[model samples]
Target chain A: MGNEYKVQVNHLTKKFGNLLVLDDISFHVKENEFLCIVGPTGCGKTTFLNSLSKLYDITAGEILINGMPVDLKKHNVAYIFQEYSNMPWLTIRQNVEFGLRIKHRPEAEIREQTDYFLDMVGLTKFQDYYPDQLSASMLQRAAIARAFAVKPELLLMDEPYGQLDIELRFRLEDELIRLWREVGTTVIFITHNIEEAVYLSNRILVLTNKPTKIKEEIHNDLPRPRNIADPAFVELRRKVTDLIKWW
Target chain B: MNQNKNGTKDNKKYILMSICSVLVFLFIWELVTDVLGIFKSTMLPSPVKVFGTFIDKFTNTKPDGATIQVHTLASLKVALSGYLIGVGIGVPLGIAMAWFRKVDCFVTPLFDLLRPVPGIAWLPVLIVFFGIGLLSKAMVIFLSAFIACVINSYSGIKNTRMVHLWVGQTFGATRSQLLFKVAIPTALPMIFTGLKVALGASWNALIAAELLASTKGLGFMINQARGIYRPDIILVGMIAVGITGAILGYLIELLQKLVMKRGWRQ
Candidate 1:
């Protein structure tokens, strides 16, 4: 049996008491696919990710990874939240190595992965600094490095660069793409920024407000090293913006 | 290097100011008692006389059974033993109560019931069970410190950020690993606070315990001074308790600095 999809969300529905949040959402993320989920503000985007991560128990349906139920112990899943998730007490190097250490990887492998990710994220110089001492962008970079160091089978990012400035976001997005291409891990990134969706995703999943359901699944076939100023990039960005525009 | 030098200079200036303030206070105390004769010599002795008694007690044991240093050491032995026992039991018990529902259910009701009862109130019961010796006094100090440690440790573990736990769980941390690695580390700052509170409480309770039945402690010395109508000896005992308490608090703060490594002074 061939399982083409790395993640399969089968009729996922979630409710908080009587209030419905996610309404029968179904999607498939191919192996190593960079899938961006974009929606308007207050559109249950976080709820969707929580359900996928099993942080919240779904009211109906199941989330499968590689033809099996999503079991955290059996499969490696990583999440990068918008808030700086670096443990404040740990140094940047320790933060990067946290996931690997939790998984009990070999010491040599842990050191190797920690160094590689820290270098890739351009944080090797500040590896000894605690999270509180670093800038906001640097903290996010550490979070990214930590997530990637584990070599996760599935990576979920919830607007990880939402608080970052435009220039820093672009730079980090480039680093993220580079790491993604190098590692080839399936990613489900949720954000409200249409340009960011068009810029980073291989495919964009647009969602509706309130009880969020898939509005559109637009395939993005743009060339690598996408330019925000490029007319083609602008066109795709506008298309996604139009689909999710509530105002 | 320049900043370091400036910091040292500022620290020295603060210490000098603190010493000057203490001297002003002592001068006022001397003025009221010795110079103006506002209170009787027996009621309020001059600062010089108190200092004289403090120095005399170091060498001579005429007033008390033992010297001030020996008395302090005896009090410390009882206080520390009980305080350590309290920390040993309270911290792990508090963590368990916070983390596990079964533990909380079993411990919280009884803890709440005992928490309101004063440590001194237990003196009679402790003396009856353990006999009026070092054990009874130590048990009293233990009870006082134990409540503070348990409450602080419980709140510490309870207040662990949800996101930190989520991060650990997402990374495949086992239950024990999450408790030890994530929960415990996150709870350390609060645990330190608990230890400091417990230390002070134990010291305060030690006075009451010593007042019951003891021959060699600052509290016993104070009681003995009152019986003999020697206010100078009482003053010396009070000063000794204050200085020792301040020193112990400072030592605990140092331990907090060593353990946390976050540069949090308070």
Candidate 2:
């Protein structure tokens, strides 16, 4: 059986009491695919990611990884949230190693992965600093480092750079692309920024507003080291913005 | 490392000011009782007189039937016994109650009942049950410390950020792992706060219990001195309590620093 997709969502429905948030949404993410979910504000994008990560129980449907039901114990999934959930008590290096340590990786592997990710994120110098002591960009990088260090089968990012300035966001988006290429892990990134989705994703999933459903799936075939000012990039961004634009 | 060079200099200045303030206070105390002789020696002894009695306490146990060291050691024994036991049980129980519903259901009712009743109010009952020896006094201290520790620790674990726990869960951490690795470390500051609060409560409760009904402790020494009209001995006992409490607080800070340094690396 050829399981070409890494993640499969079958009729993913979620409701809060009587209010339906994700309305029988279904999607697929291919192996090592950088899929971005973009929508208007309050469009249940976060709820979709939470359901995929199993952070919230689904009201009805099922989420699958490698064609099997999403079994958390059997498969490792890493997440980078908007809040940058680095443990305050841990240093940057320790925070990077948090998931690896929780998974009980070997000491040598923990040290190796921690150092590699820390260096890749350009945070080796600040590895000894706590999360509170670092800048907003640095904290987000530390979170990315922590998520990548685990070598997860799938990674979910919920607008991880939403709080950063534009410059920091661009720099981090490049680092995220470098990480995605190097590790080749399946990623489902949620954001409302049309440019960001066009810039980072190999495939973009556009979602609608309340009673949210898939609005469009934009496949981005731009060349690597993407130039956002490039006409094709601008064209794709305009297309995605048109798909989910409420205002 | 959190402090800068300017911060270090400011800290030194603050230390100097603190020293000067204490000296000024001592001078004023000496002025009224010794230099001006405004108060009788029996009413409010001079600093010199208190110092003399503090020295005399080592060699002479005439007034309180025990040396200052002996009284301090006895008080320490009762206070620390209750303090360690209270914190040991209270912290884990609090964390458990917050993390697990079964534990919360079992302990919260008794906790609510005991929290309102002051530790001093239990002295008569404890004294009647266990007598005025170390057991009853320790029990009195236990109630005070336990309530303080439980309240702080419970809040500490309860207040762990939801996002942090989600991070752990997304990584497939077991409940125990989440509690220990994420929740407890996140709760470190408040748990230490619980420890400090419990220490203060235990100290105060021990003294009250000893003052009401005990033969040998700093509180008993002060009470005996008051009966015998030895103001100097009373002053020594009071100073002893203050200094000891400060030292215990410093020790807790030392423990906090060790835990909070973020050096427990993989």
Candidate 3:
């Protein structure tokens, strides 16, 4: 059972000075699972994700990728920040190739991966455009392509589409789902939007306010191409929404 | 297309206005000195007299021991040498200081102590060590430019966004790779700004050192004019300095634009 899980977080705890942000949170993500985490505003969701990526040093407990302890040098991880993390100086093609280059992949593999991801995100035509030249949605697409090109074992996204309009958000969400399906990479997406959690994840983890703990983890068996207006989708969204309401 | 046409038209008008303003200023100076005779010729040379002196100084070397071209070249050589040395040393030292904690701890205290002392204040000590030769003068200019380069480069590296660093780390970048590929590229605009400031400072320091100590150079030519009470010669030296400084600054700006064509502005 332990080996079956890709990510096993055991009693993860984090604090800033005297203020406790995350308190004894425990969870496991199956291999290639699409897990979405939703919580109330200021519920330390970002802190939790940051801890998993070792961006924030946890005060206690451990995080494991596979059966071994999580080590950035040993494991492959990719993060998509709320703000666009595309290197402004690199063109779209170069940006997509950045991680592969860092990892010292074979030249042919780097080009093939970069090309595949760029095409997947529909950015092949804009490969020469710098991040500044692209529109907001296009910039996010470039970021996505860059992340996917790395073929990371764990993909952590922190409200990556939080700033986009609803229409663009849905479009990118669909693209994300398609990419996830094809790539089969384990994904842990953190968002404040309940509908987003319902629309994307195989399972949703609802977290509590302040000293955040796992309120519940609801398994989502909703079929592919989920409709927001579907009764099951609405029921699941409402359940997650009810669990996250703090006030 | 219409907006670009309007922009070009406005740009032309501005150039015309700039030329007219310079002419008007020269006219006023000529009125005060020659036509009105409000001031003696020795006190303020007329624009025409200054113009004549500019041409005469190029051909005549009696007043300064060298032609204007030779003096200009000497000044430029000394200034550029000091400027390049300062950039070569200061930029790397600054980046190292920002990137390594041990380097920062070792260098910061000494740097802070010396930072407030003006570059010209080192003149007496430098002259004593190196004597009143080109070396001493170049050292002063080097110190002046070095301070600007060190400060800007350090800040530039220190101010790279944490998010950028995190992204680099996630991709399995080594410490050295992060510094070279992420921090340095991110710091380029500030590095260029430092280069510009250092350039201007180098020029100022060069002129000051030449005026005080050198036997040849633009500063020496101006100082010689002062000794001989040739206001026209002094006016010519001042104009030359102004034009050369503007041209150097413009060249740096052009280089910056050429390198940053891919929207580093973002």
Candidate 4:
């Protein structure tokens, strides 16, 4: 609980050729904190997340994890892509075990970890099923299960539920929050949905359109077992929505 | 519902009718040739005689007056050997070119320069260097099939999604691991597509090689029939080539399905 300041970003700037994607962005993610970033479409939220994970080189900035530089070779980071990220050739169980296998964990440990996550995500019955055989919600669940099973120090997701419908999205969102709570891993989630951002995040960071800079930061002080119908939840959604809508 | 079912049944009936129509045309061909007696037997043998010759040759141990099994086995050997060599070289080269920008730039112009010349056009040069033997025939096939495979394999790897790469990178995969596990697996469907096209090209090249220079093979058999003025034998050879090519292609399709069944859904 005390390690909540696990990730710190200072003056991060990223550019692609002549175009600037992120401008002077700075943020801190407390350990075990669910930090959600919301911006208008193409506001460079994804790029910012990528920069934090070192998927993209920052034009100017520094990111620290646990009081040290974020070295990809040393620290473990997992990204849950927006769409079906599981390889079609691998089954549900195998997909969940892919990262562990790549990291060359022992066979016994891999099997036990895979089985545990498959059950955690309610996909134990479909362990042998391929990505194409699963429904969209189920595939997302499998992907999330895969990312979490790696036990990453920091989990980065790029609109993981952006493609899903309202009902499935919310259900998966619930599962995600549950997983985050149980694992207590630092999370940085990116989305354009104001409600989803407010619903899942303990803190929200809003950014302006491309050549983007942070527009606002809001702390969601809502208690656990958060009710979407609560006034505070509605107010937070409204504030985030207004920031993007007016921009 | 009944009308839709009936419509599908009628579609099948239509196809059957179309086939019968072709048979009827052949029947008229036989009748006209018989009644008119317009051509000599040497010029255009009757369909009955050609078919009879085909059956006698195919079924009997010594009907065609030549050792067809020897010819067939020779041709198969040339085709399979050339095809295997081509795939072995082309698959890796293609993947390398696509994966590395420097390699692609270096090799693109060379391949482009060599690709336009058909395999047959190289026959004279090959004959001069290797003579009219198995090596020359295999060379023709290798040249024809290699280009097709390289292009397909290159495109397959080139088009791999960055998301998959990022997925691997974020998971702490080394450069080699990412290339082999993510890029190669993702590119497999296209690689098979290339192999299928290359195989078809290999068959085309075989005939071209045999036509130019060969001691024994189906291509040589067909060329020999042409020189001896035996139209029936020519027809048999033609049928043999067509049937064998189709059968080989079918087998390749089955093999592709079997080897790739795990990832077939994508």
- A-chain TM-score, model 4: 0.95
What does candidate 2's lDDT look like per residue over B6-43, in tens digits?
89999999999999999999999999988999999999
**lDDT by residue (tens digit), candidate 1, B1-266:** 99999999999999999999999999999999999999888999999999999999999887778999999999999999999999999899889999999999999999999999988799998888988789999989989889998999999899878777778878878889889978888788888889999999999999877876787799999999999999999999999999999999999988887778752222
Backbone clash count for every predicted candidate, in the order shown? 0, 0, 0, 3
- Chain B TM-score of candidate 1 stands at 0.92
Scored by TM-score, the top model is 3
Range of the 10 consecutive residues with the lowest summed lDDT in candidate 1 chain A? A82-91
lDDT of 4 at B24: 94
Candidate 2 docks with a DockQ of 0.52
Enumerate residue pairs that collide in model 2. Answer: none
Badly placed stretches (over 4 Å) of model 4 are: A1-4, A245-247, B1-29, B32-39, B55-66
Model 3 regions lying over 4 Å from their true place:
none
Q: Chain B TM-score for each model? A: 0.92, 0.93, 0.97, 0.87
Question: Candidate 3's C-alpha lDDT?
Answer: 0.91
Q: Candidate 4, residue B80: CA error in Å?
A: 1.3
Per-residue error (Å), model 3, residue B47: 2.0
Q: How high is the CA lDDT of each candidate model?
A: 0.91, 0.90, 0.91, 0.86
Q: What is the TM-score of candidate 1?
A: 0.95
TM-score, structure 3 vs. true:
0.96
B1-266: candidate 3 lDDT, tens digit per residue: 99999999999999999999999998899899999999899999899999998999889997889999999999999999999999999899889889999999999899989989878789889999998888998898899889889999999999888888888887778899899888998888888899999999999888888888898999999999999999889889988988888888999999999887574786
